[model samples]
Structures are given as structure tokens and as C-alpha cells.
Target: MSEHHTLYAAFAERIDAVLSALELEGALPPGTSRANVSVEPPRDPSHGDLATNAAMVLAKPAATNPRSLAEKIVEHLSRDPLIESAQIAGPGFINLRLARSTWTDELAAIAALGGDYGKSAMGEGRRVNIEYVSANPTGPMHMGHCRGAVVGDALASLLEFAGHAVTREYYVNDAGGQVDTLARSVHLRYREALGEDVGAIPDGFYPGAYLVPVGEAAAQEFGDRYRSAPEAEWLPVFRAFAVERMMAIIRADLQLLGIAHDVFSSEAALQAAGKPEAAEAWLRAHDLVYDGVLEAPKGKEPPDDWEATELPLFRSTRFGDDQDRPIRKSDGKWTYFGADLAYHMQKAESADELIDIWGADHAGTVKRIKAAVAALSEGQGEPIPFDVKLVQMVQLLRNGEPAKMSKRSGNFVTIADMVDEVGKDVVRFSMLTRKPEAQMDFDFAKVVEESKDNPVFYVQYAHARIRSILRKGADENFAPSAEHLGLLGEDDLALVKRAAQFPREVEMAARTREPHRIAFYLADLAAELHAFWNLGNADQQKRFIVAQDANLSGARLFLAAQIGQVIRNGLALLGVEAVEEL
Candidate 1:
């Protein structure tokens, strides 16, 4: 109830009370701000339970000695009921130890909350749009897009769990040059399907045979209708057919990984009929549209046909970007950036906060999107903010060798192939085991290896062991008694302490917009659970399913059940299956 009031909160509240009492909210000492206060568990448990640097931050501003100010703050915090003691430590840092019963009460609260132990209301129902895995409509999703897909889906789930109203979106680049190439490739396959001698695909076109079915379907649907038609006469029909089929394939691939988008915004539809002038109008209204000639190439000479011309540009540099970006080409064709600006503008109308999940190749594009948002919200009292997260590449390896790329998918590993080789649970969990910003190596052999080194299996095994303990307890007629909890020992206390920290961890991960934090936390929690179980192996009295002592077994069984439930809930949010019988 009321978020269970984490023990660290009291330490933070005490620091805030001291600041308020001193009336020092304006600014802060050099290189630090008064609002930079943070209370976290000490890295070294020997130091203390929690540590803070409020005194160090306020030292110069308050014109007091660092250690002396820390001593005063320690004294003020020692008066709190939750704190057992507060000590002034290294360089004016205050380390606090909480009463043992505080953790005991936290365990009881976690048991009461059950599956909802770590749920928070921090989001306050704010709407957040998460656009991710908007892969090109040319083919199925590959391994490169897997990590971002998992991260975006898990982050969206984490936000929802933390009380945010989130919209999951997928942007389709159907109107781009790639999709146009897709149409021509399908036409080649269409002729082959019609029994024509279209041997091997020529260079500069898609050589993947995955489009064979698409071509066959088109030929069957419109027999001889577009066989002799000009490219212009059939481009529209073929492009629509090819894109729709590719999208179906992509959707199926996402389904294999348990990901679904709430909306699939198309670049074609954004400017299809009457929306082309919309983006230009908005740009002109914001004065971001300008006609300028870009400098010619420095390292290599341009083609003889290349000519200098003035083009419309968006002043992205005003929003902390490196330089201005072009919105249109000299041939009067809208560049990719122009379509993206319109897409984001359309997204802002529906959601106040917009977040894009893109590959590292789009790192240079981040500033322009932010600049467009600022320009669009220039005069409005309420402005919509956008954030773009660039996910680095994932190199898939197997048996210490680079995995062979499938030519059917055009030099990439499809998500379907990945999930088929590795189960959905392993693929989803392993992908998110690290931060999305970090470049990850997905070693197929190690992921399937059954050991602690494999986080997915380790966590699943922990849940399975918990279930086995409960089943054994049931066979021994061990049901938790109200009076049995008094038997909780030192090992039990340690387990409960880690369990009680779940809510605080969830809040931190959600606030930081990082779902990998959950993955890492679950790994730690699993280790603690496994360690606690191994302790039982060395000592008969510590066993959770003691045949001789039903009362002791009852208390331990309840704790084990609680652990299994928490692990299940957390893994579910990450889109990883939690098996009770693995």
C-alpha cells in the first residue's frame, strides 16, 4: 500500500526536509545542484544500507565544513523510526542503516501484494508513443532488428506496468525507393511464375527467392492484365500488392517474437492523396523552409550531370543540431527527411510524447526530428517532446564463428529463423539482457547452454525450483500457518531483503527508460534464490520441504511461492516465458 514506502525513501525525505528547513532551494554549490540528491544502496554492503551526498552538495553554499555538515545531517536522520543509525563517512557522505524489522515488514507487504509487488503509479497515466521496428517493407525482419523490437516492446510493457498510457507504433516506409525496387523484383518473379524464362535475377535488383510467391500471386490475380503494360501503367498496382504482401510477412515475423504494434503508419498514406502540401505548409508556417544550395563533394568529384541548385531546407541547427538538413532534392522530389518530418508531426497530434526506436544508422537524424518538434510547438503553450533511441547493431554468432547469412532474406538473418532455431523465450530474454545502446553479440551456442552463464535458463530454472519446493510442501501437508513465520532465519531474511527491493528497482528502470535494468535485476534475484536453495543442500534444517517439521516447511514454502510469483510476473513483462516445469 502507498508503494510500500521503500527504506531508501526515508533517507531521501530526511535530506529534503533538511534542505527545506535551511531554505536553500535556489541553486547550489559549484559543479553541483541542490536537486541532484539521490539515495541509493551502498555499493559495498559493509559501508551501510543506503548512502547520500546532500552535505557534500550543499557544503560550499551553506559555508560549512563537509564532514561537519554531514555529521549534522546524520544526526537529523537518526531521529527517523525507520533508521537504526546514520554515520558520517568518506568525504561528507551520509550512510544509513535501517532497522531489521523494517525489511521484515517489507517482506510481509510484498507477500500481500503478490503478483503486483513491484507495480508503481509514477507515470500518472501520461501518454507515451513508442515507435519501433519500423523495418523496410521490402522483406521479413532480420536479426539486426530483433534487439530493438524486444527492447521497444519490453519498454512499452514496463511503461504500462509503471502506469503510463502508451501507444506502440510501427512506421512503414512503403513509399520509399526500396519499396519501389520491391515492386520490380516481384514483377521478375511474376514472369517466372507465368512460366517465362526469367533465369537468374540481374544485378541491382533483389535476388531473394522469397518474392517468388508474391509474384505468383500477382500473376494469378491479374493474368496478362499488366504483362504488356508500361512500367508507369502497372507500378501503382504492383507497388501496392508487393508492399501489402511484405507487410503480412513482417507481421508474421513479429508474431513469432510476440510483438504487436497498435498502429502501422505508412509513408505512402502520409502523403498519398492530399497530404503532400501538409508538411510543406507546416514548414513554411514555422519558417523552417529555406532554399539553399548544398556544397559539392570534397573528396570525390560529382558526376558530370550533377548541377548546383537551391532547395528547401529545415534549420535543424537551431535545436542543437550540427547543421541544417535538406527537405527536398533539386529534382522537386521530397527527401526521406521531409516525409519523416510529416510523419512525426502527424504522430504528435495523437500523442503528447513521441519516442522513436531506430538503428544506429539514424544517429545523425535524431537532431532534425527534435528540431521539427520544437519548431512545430514554437507558439503553442503545450509542446510535444520527442526522443529517439538508436539501437546499435547485433552480430549473431554460433560456435565462435560468424553465422551464415541467409541469401533468401538478402544477406540477413530473419526473425523467424532466429525464433525457430531458438525458442521465443530465449530470443526475447537474451536480446534484452543488455542495454539497447550497447552493441550486443548473440552467441547462439551460449544462449542454449544450460548453465548460470545463460541468464534465460538460470531465471527459468529458479522459478522451476521454487515451484518444485511448493509442490513438495503440498505433498507434506505444509500450509503456511500464521504462527510459523516466526521461524524465518538469517538465510530467509536475506532472501526477503532482495525480494523487498523489487518495487524500487522497477521505478528506477521505468524512470530511466531502460528495460534492460529489469533483465539484470531478474538475473540477480535468480542468483539470490539459487544461492538460498544451495544453502539448504548443505544444511538439512534449512530445507524448504522438511518432512520432519511441517511448521518450518510452511513458512519457507510461502516465501518460495512468493519468489516464484515475482519471477513469473517480471519475466512476463519482458516478453519471456516463465516455466514452472522447465
Candidate 2:
């Protein structure tokens, strides 16, 4: 979508042009749509550089068979100067092999673009709000919350690269039962700070040692002010103090993994501002919410205390949810979903798109929120697109065995612990190796290993190796440039083809909102660099640093530099550093 067009986009445009010309000649139907037509790299590289199903998609409307239509399209495409050859394959696909000059041109473009090589204007500056790692401020973030943080962060980076004005956000569940418990625990520590006989933390209170510091800090700040006060007099003050302290801990923990949210929206702030009340009133006017609900949820045993109390419920069933969701509990308290919807409603007013990253355990909640967005659009005029990505759990492993709790946080393995065990780059890259929806194991032993199975090390090693080769070339007065890029041969062209795919890969991944694809791509690029390096081990002529041939050395070194730059860019999106040394 950028002003600087990539080869993939160019080819797609050319195919569209060909179809437009066919329409002019009445060879194809006048109103044939080409929106679904796509020109992409062939599944098998040996078949061709690119393939398109344009012929097949248009053949039905043209009143012609796919084979004959493909032949006609190929006739026009073969005349293109950039295309070496065009042939019909399968039932209707048109395969194209681009001239070698095209690959060289793309490499030159990569050189000109540098860090911005794979960037695109696909997002068109639309505002995107991405909320991730909304972990309750009850405790420090553990591996339970790490995947969502990494995924959301990477996705925000990816969208920005693809030209979106993205805001990375976190929701503070300060007005929750969990935070109240956190306050109670802090109070115990606060009492202990006053040298009281608060012997041991009860079973319900948080006993993590991390809060000891918070208690000490609170006691030093306010001496015995709440020691004898009633719950009404002290709860609010203590809750405010504790939530701030808990957030500080959460922010520091997120920083260990290179995450810092752009905004931290508070549930307490929303409630205090009467946002939920306003949302409920608006929904009532639209008939989206009503006083209803008495049926027990299926598959769950009814609690003995359960009563058929009429409560206010959202008409989520009108959309995709299985049943109406209660917005207010029987006790007249707003449900978590109701408050969350108000938070999302806040998001809708400012952004063109809304994306929430949540744990897979919250999968049942996706539909209701989506319904809320739809209902909001119905009441309002404009639409705000919303999507929720669920990240599954990460099982911690050490030496091929399940790793246990963190000594630092007490309850679970904290993100800080993982970063301490194996640096941030390893933690970030390893978390992204799998798609968010699929469960994965973070094997500390394997992640740090120097082998192909270890993507973090393997990919970084490639960049480091390339840097070494470039340094050697630097000593020999060999410089890479577009002027010497023409020395590349068949295998060299293959490498360029792979490099050129970076832009297309970035665009596709951004379109799908899948940043994991970027990690997979970097791994493949690393493999190519390593495989090409191995060729140097067996043959001296294939070496990047050749004292006998300065021209060849410059060309090969140029290719290496481009590969390294791309690796750096891809790793940057995943919030991992591209190390020059392992």
C-alpha cells in the first residue's frame, strides 16, 4: 500500500490491468469483479515465481472454459518486460517467471529502503486501540499472562509498520474482588509494618513476599493512620494506595519483557465517572438491555444459594451469543462484562478499530462484547471494527521437565523470572514461535541451545555470522552496492527471491493480524543465510570474502547486509533484539 510499490503488489496490479483490458475488448464480461483475484508466489518455487487464479475466477462470467481463458491472459502477460515467461498450469492458473533484472531491482529497492524495506501503507493511518495483559493488579504477572503481552505488543508493532496509528493499552481491574483481596493482604503487611501481632497471612489473603515491600513503603508513607479506622474510613484510601503500588509492580514486570502500554484505563475511574450507568441507559433506549434473566447456565450445577431474581441483561442472544448475558448481578452490582463493555465503548469513540488480547479461558466472552460493539454501531451512526485474540497458556519447562513456581513471586513463574533465566530476546522470540491460540511449552533448555531447534539462537547466529562476513569484507576494502548487485547467479537470485518476499510476508501477516508469521519468516531467512554460509565451507569460490575477486565479494556481501537488515527489522517487530553476537 506504500507509495514505493513492492514486486508482489506490482504483479497484482498488472494482472488487474490485463483483466480491465479484456473487459474493454468484450473478451470478458463487462461487470466482472477482480476483487477476489490475487497474484501470489507459487506454492512450489520450481513451478514459477508467481501464480494467479485470475483466469479461473473470470472464466464463468466470460462464458468460456478456464483453460482457454488462461491462455488468453497469458498472452497479454507474456508481453510484460519484467516477465521472463508466462504459462498456464493446472486447470486455469497462470504462472510467471520474472526476469533476473527484476530480482536485482528489488534488491536495490531493499538497499534504498533500509529499515523501512518491508513497511506498507495498508492501514492508511487508521487509529487502532489494542488492549493486552489486563492482568488483575492483585499480583505480579506470571507466565499465565506472558503470551498475551508478547502477542499484543508484537501485533501493535506489526500494525504500525503496516501504517496504523496504534495505541497499546492495558485495563486496570482496580474495582474488583481480587484487588480488594490485594488491599486486605497489603493491610496485613501494613499492620505488620506497625509491629502488630498479625502473625500469619490467612488462607484467603495474598501471602506473596513481593507485597512486603509495598507494606513497608505504605507504612513509611502513612503511620498508623488506618490502624484503628473502620472499613468505611480506610478501605477506599487503602484500596487507592494498594492499586497504585500493584500497578507499579505490574509495570515493572512488563518492562522486563520490553512491554509498556500507551494507556492504562482504570475500571475504578470508569465506574467513578458513571460510564457504566450511561452505557446501560443508552442500551435501554435502544432495547439492547432489559430487566430479565432467570435461567441457569447449562452444564454448571446450580448453586444452593441461587435464586430466580430478575436482573438486567444484555440482548446478546440477538447477535451471536447463546443466551442473554446479565449486565447487573442479583445484588445490583454491575457485572464484570458490563464494566468491560463500557471500557470498550470508550475505545470505540476514539479509534477506528478495537482489538483486545485475552486468555483463551475468556473465549466464552468474545461474542457478547462483539454484540455490544454491534449494538453500539446500531445506536450510533458509524461502525467500529472489533476483534479479540485469545492467547493460550504457556507451560514452563526446564531440562525437558515441567518447571515449577517462581521463588520471587511465590505462586507462579513470573515473566521476570523467565527473562532472568534466559534473556528478554529469548523470552520474546520463544513466546511467539507458536500461534496465540495454540498451547506451547517454553523449554528454557531448548531456547538457549545452539541448534536449529532453538529459533532465538539460530536466527541471531545467522545475523551475527553475516555481520562477521561483512566485517571481513570491510577489512578487504569490499563494499556492497547496487552497482555490483548484477554479479548474482541462479542460486543468488533464489536468495533474492526469498528476501523480496519479506514485504509481501509483512503485508499478509498484518492483514491477518498474525505476528507469529513474522517469527516463522525470520527463521526461514536465517536458514537461507546459514545454508548459503555452509556452501562457503565446502567451496572457496562461493565464499563472501574473496580477496582474489573484489567484485564477487562486494555482491555477496551486499546480499548478506540486506539479509541482516531484514532480520533486524523482523526481530524488532517481535520486541527481540537482533544480536550481532550470540
lDDT of 1 by residue, 1-582 (tens): 345555566557777876665555433333445677778888887786788988887888768877987876776687888788899887898888877777667666767777677888888888999999999988888988898899999999999888789999999999878888889999888888888888779887888768989999999999978876899988888999999999999999999999999999888989775454687777787778877876665558887876788888888878887777888777777789888887877788777688888899888878877888767655444778778888989988998789988767768888888898989999999988888889888988999999998998999999998988877777767875435677788788778767766778888888888988988988999999999889889988888877798788887887787777778778978998788687
Model 1 TM-score (2 dp) = 0.91
Per-residue lDDT tens digits for candidate 2, residues 1-582, read 335676889989988888888899889988788887988999999999999999888888899999999988999998999999999998999999999899988887887788898999989999999999999988898999999999999999999999999999999999888878888889889989888988877999998998998889889988999887787787777889999998999999999999999999999999999989999999999899989755865557887776688988999989878889988887777899999888888888888899999999999999999989878855667768899999999888889899989886887998888889898889999989999899899888999999998888888999999888888788878887567777887877888899899988889999999999999999998898888888889988878877798888888888888888889889998999887765
Which portions of model 1 show Cα errors greater than 4 Å? Answer: 1-7, 10-34, 58-80, 273-276, 300-303, 320-322, 407-410, 480-483
RMSD of 1: 3.4
lDDT of 2 at 340: 89
Q: Estimate each model's TM-score.
A: 0.91, 0.97
The lDDT of each candidate is 0.82, 0.88
In candidate 2, which residue pairs get closer than 3 Å at backbone N, Cα or C atoms, i.e. clash? Answer: none
